[model samples]
Target: MATSNLDLADIQATVLRYRPEPYYGTHVLLRIDDARGGREFLRRLVPHVASAADWWLRDDAWIAVTLSYAGLVALGTPEQSLRSFPASFREGMAARAEHLVDVGLNGPQNWEPPFGSSQVHVALSIFSGDQLKWRQAVETAWAQFRDLRGVTLLMSQDFGAQPGDRNSLGYKDTIGQPAIEGSGVEPLPGQGRPIKAGEFVLGYPGETGVVLTMPQPDLLGRNGTYVGLRKYQSRVGAFNRFLRENANTAEERELLAAKLMGRWRSGAPLTLAPERDDPAIGADPRRNNDFDYANDAHGYQVPFGAHMRRMNPRDTRLAQLTDVNLHRIIRRSTTYGAPYDPDALSERDDEIPRGLYFIALSAKLMDTFEFLQREWINKGDFMTLGRERDPTVGLQENDAVFTIPKHPVRRRIHGIETFNVLRGGEYLFMPSLSALRWLANLGG
Candidate 1:
């Protein structure tokens, strides 16, 4: 089940669904099942995929398949699962690969499972309303897969979001997206930032164990990129209130949200038309990633402190931007738990604590995840002055007291408070489709 190139139409034809990638969104993961005789089991399953598109469907749509030390006990026959596979198995399918664990490496036979090892976690992106049906299909499929040992499912949908939505926040999600200028994925324009060959696929000679390198080169073509999955919570109510109280004018409030977010809610990027909404420009594929911040001298038009500006500054020199943003993740976050009910908007006490199940693919986590959290999002004044805290999901250094400047140019401090908290997250290196198959049948 390997193909050189999988067009969107063909992918849609097979999955019977399609979702054009977005800058910010949700990814839903369903824990399906696990098998113990890992490599052997996967070896037998790979050929059964039937087509290359099926492999891509699994690779792009499925999240990481994390195995644990406790997996041996869960295999039901610890002794059998503990037995070592031939060296050829290591050579042919597992040399220099990270996390290619032996049965008893972490602990002797008597030990329990490691922190997250007892089960194999399988995840899928929540594309649309059809996800419920898709989840059911995935559950049935895994249960029926012969190699999987015992299957149990847990729905993980609660997660957080990046700052700035259309309504009140001064932002839009994924401000500067790279248009494939010459067929390859060049993260964005202004700086010939072409997504390198090794960036997305694996099994290439130099790419083994490299987190940013692509995993499945033989199966996926040159442009195919790997996605990462994460979940985060957003304090929409608190964020909305902050803008209402802080902003001097409705226009300023709207501008701030758009600036911080990188786009107007109408999906327009502040880089192109910073002042007002431009529906046509935002929607135009040819023009969206065409602008740069060099034109804005004072950081007023598109604030230097703006999340989009700081994250993707569009410069080879002087920008001091990290190489991470080049591995641009297409965030597919969606609100989970309970829908934002119009009636609940006015409630004195929220009946349910809600958030997002964040998901996206990146060549490396540091480039995408850590940088966004530690540098761009967490740093109170990212690229400019008076822009401390994202007001929605951004972390405040201290809960005791806080303030944000009125304008990116003014630096006038305004009182603020802590908003959201990051409850939990894990850095999972989602393996290529072949890697998953190799993992499933380890000993068998």
Candidate 2:
């Protein structure tokens, strides 16, 4: 019997497409006032949902729909059916409330209403190359729901970022993602090994060769996956100030930044070009993700605590003990706010409302996404680095320190502050394309 049971046509587009180009996107959060009315709304919206097959064509506008724990219940899903979902999704992001604060999420007191509060029901995402086209697609799809009695569009966030690769912080993002076994995107030279398709999609064997448990009905869980969505607010002015205070020259500053992120601003890996930035190497698809930390175990070239290394410790000693492959996640991030002016770095004091709309997909929410945030990114003891945290995205205070291992002794940088703050987020169930139809036709 085949170990994999995935029908690519049944999966959602976002689960596999690493980079859907010409990207202009929006996320609309909705609240369902009445269970019956909400189910009716889904009935009308099913035709617009894009599938994995749709993404392969890479031409027309695309849309995906996911639901919060409250969403499934609000849509009249039976209690038994609701119980079938994973605990992480069912209890929702609030279950990790205390952990969220430790990971630098804005405290519970400051969390936006309906985000961690279980008030949001539906999450609709629409993306396209043309801004106007994306907007029209959203409007056309939600036309009926606009006046529906029980459905309310609580918030609609517009994300417009050019080039579709770099984040608001001026660094190339999404350079270290694992290539799923069946994603069609080939693994690069230094990307290590191709992760199992089951690690991401349901009904397939993950690293353990045991198929992850699916919810009751096969159709509802077969091609489905869990998603963790968070909106990050970047502190660009503060980051620039830190570099200025730490490094004297522009070249030195770039190198320091590379130490913090494990990749140059141009996407070059520090392990490959430890001395300086190499734009050509970073730009080459084959070379950018072709290096690992085995040779630089002491983190001389790539700091052990660097954001990339901490997130994905590819084929290192840690991998020997723990299966890092099981913890892999597919990231789909987009910058929301305008880029900060590099020239005005000195005059800026106030914070800017710009950062990434972060999204990560995996089969098990707690085992992968939550584990990474709580155990790896927020803590550094696993790498034997002590209390130090990831300078790029870790939770930090004035006393935070980052050490660079030199031959004779180590150099330490102190007074580090967190540059990324979580504004809002939620755990959602990204059901299969067929499951979506089943949800729409629930009662009828």
Candidate 3:
């Protein structure tokens, strides 16, 4: 009988190169199921792990192989030159028992069935830093593990700098991100999203509110959330030209840009220090999270419908939604493109290549993704006065370009236009590594 197991030694070798933390480059996401014989397979796989700190320590880290379901099928084609393992491994898998759920890309929405069902996943990074050294290590690792065939390397173009680097979005990204721990004020103790008991032990003690919990009996350490990735292509030059043509004064243009983003390009929020950019408050953990748009009479510091305000409005008195934290997502956006030049500012040529790979992890895509897109980013009438638009990410209906007349103190901004586009993306599930391997060798 054909078996669904691969040589673990081969898999282990491919995994050893990514050690020493601070992952180098090239992210690999694997979605897996628990092999028929479960705990024994996990026991066999645990010794081969590359990072002890990452594998065991981190709350989100996992030992299972994982991937989006569609992503796994892509590796199944003949062109990949895949080889299968012997029948004996399947015997081992069938003996040990554990949960099996598709970790990524469910069917109907995801396409095709017999997709691996267990929710184990693993995300790893491939490197290019030391050139020959990195290549040598990768080759050595590949020689050992290529036979496993469950793993797929994402091969990121670059790690890309953390949040602030300008993506195609035409503005600095990832500003006002919350601290992992100390924010001075206590975090609201809300059991925002509830997962089953088993999931809590797998990897998500805190992921409850970040990802929606599922109903199936075996949470299998795969509950409490969803992960979304959007690659946005920005028209940078178009934005610059629009600013020049619209605002009467340079100060007026800068203020408008700041209002759209909720913070200045320098990382300052308009709410705290409205008149001027405050790099100090922008960088501070205490003040940034503490801001609510309760007292901005001028609307100069931060407008009511600015992307930040619409996404995380500080106005506690205005009881419009269930809770503010319900919509909060942990953003991990990376900018892709060249630095903007002053000379290029005047060129209205639309060929500039820039944008952001927007990644957000949340408990519910409904609140985090839908709310932001429909209610805030794409909402034409987000504000009661019909004044502000999400300057950076707003989409105009029927491709209509309308203007938001200026505040009383500020001059009118005219000739405004929509400057970005959402190319394409699908919702993805990120599972721990153990889940990834089970899917890779599922059919035998």
lDDT of 2 by residue, 1-444 (tens): 112235767888888565555477888899999987898888788777877764445436678899998999998877778898887678778667565443334654456666777788999888776667787888876795997889998888877554525677778777677777766655668777888888888888887888898875888888888888887777877788888889999899889988999999889999889998999988777888888777997889988878888888886566226778878888888778777544436424326667888888888865677677767877777788778877877878658898888788988988677787777788898999888888878778
Candidate 1, number of clashes: 50
RMSD for all candidates, in order, please: 9.3, 2.7, 11.8
What lDDT, from 0 to 1, does candidate 3 have?
0.42
Ranking by lDDT: 2, 3, 1
Q: For each candidate, give its TM-score against the true structure.
A: 0.62, 0.93, 0.61
Winner by lDDT: 2
> How well is each residue in 259-349 modelled by candidate 1, as lDDT tens digits?
5556676667776786698878765656666776666655666655555655565641333444543545544444444433322323232
List lDDT for all candidates, in order.
0.40, 0.78, 0.42
Please estimate how well model 1 matches the true structure, expressed as its whole-model Cα lDDT: 0.40
Runs in model 3 lying further than 4 Å from the true structure = 1-66, 72-156, 162-171, 178-212, 215-224, 248-252, 285-288, 316-322, 346-349, 380-382, 385-389, 398-412, 437-444
Off by over 4 Å in 2: 1-5, 57-59, 100-105, 162-164, 343-350
